[model samples]
Target: MTPIRRYATAPGVPAAVGPYVQATSAGGFVFTTGQIPAAPGQEIGTFADEVRATLTHLAAVLAEAGSGLDRIVKLNAFLGSPEQLDVYNQVYETFFTDHRPARTTVCVGLWGVALEIDCIAVTGPGGDA
Candidate 1:
């Protein structure tokens, strides 16, 4: 027997600019693409704002796939610099108030963007997982 694999699409989330799906699920787990911090045509804001937007997109993708922020088991994030970690945590706390997933944040050479984030989560009852 073979397990099922599914591709997920998030409504209200602008189509991925690249050739990649927003999310995919298999074996009771959901994996998301790295969410860009800016919304469609929306200019990038402050470091905190960028983190908030990225997380919002991540949550939306998880919700669309029958998961959510609290369900996240692992989160991977990228930043333009290490100096913004404190500000990022302040904004991140607002989204992940109760459940905190294992996370990794790395400083990267990003162009015109402060952050990008992706996550893995457990599917809810609505999902096969």
Candidate 2:
């Protein structure tokens, strides 16, 4: 089993999972865990709000791993409700302003959150062209 490198800071986004790395870098790629709107016990507002908040945390994780959202090449989005799809896309477009990574949106019976997002990005120090 190969162990991926993990990065963390003294003051950074807190992880709810006990054994989750902020970001994992392996096999020439960086994989980030699913991010939810639960920010250190902050109450989640709306689906769009959760999506935006989660993405912000993901960006921070990428930064800690020497990467950024612009470098993301793929994403997996899980939504509790299908009706929020349009709003999710709108907020996603607003944040991922540069690289529009290939994405998969899944409508599930229930997510661990109102919105959840995980990403796979190239591990490097360049923004999308």
Candidate 3:
């Protein structure tokens, strides 16, 4: 029998800008959709601000799915401009701290947003369940 997929939502996190859920969990892992910087009814801002907002939303999504930033195993980050890479990294480090999840970052065209981030995390304590 196939395991059921569980969708996650958090009031503090911004709603999906497109037709997608915030995150989903299955088989002991939670996968988050790429989070854009713009929140509901909020104005998008600078590159650093976008990075912070995006990660903050990611954190909330993970938490809602019984995971957390520290439990994240991988991250796919997209930047609107390669020039903003340094700023993104600095702000990202502030949130991730010692939890060094494997990551990939690339420059891409984003609609009205400077950055987007998505992650995969294990469920339960220290992602060990």
Off by over 4 Å in 2: 1-3, 8-11, 39-42, 126-129
Q: lDDT of all predictions, in order shown? A: 0.81, 0.78, 0.82
Candidate 1, run of 10 with poorest lDDT: 1-10
Q: Note the clash tally of each candidate.
A: 0, 0, 0
User: Would you list the clashing residue pairs of candidate 3?
Assistant: none
Candidate 3 regions exceeding 4 Å error are 40-44, 127-129
Q: What TM-score number comes out for model 2? A: 0.83
Off by over 4 Å in 1: 1-8, 39-41, 126-129
TM-scores for the candidates: 0.86, 0.83, 0.88
Query: Could you give the C-alpha RMSD of every candidate to the true structure, in order shown?
Result: 3.2, 2.9, 2.3
The numbered model that scores best in lDDT is 3
lDDT of 1 by residue, 8-123 (tens): 45865656876788998878888899887775457766777778778888888988887899899899989888998999989988998878889999999876667788899998
Write the residue-wise lDDT of candidate 3 on 1-129 in tens digits: 546465645767777667778888888889899887776446766778878888888888888888889999999998878899889889988998878899999999877667788999988765333
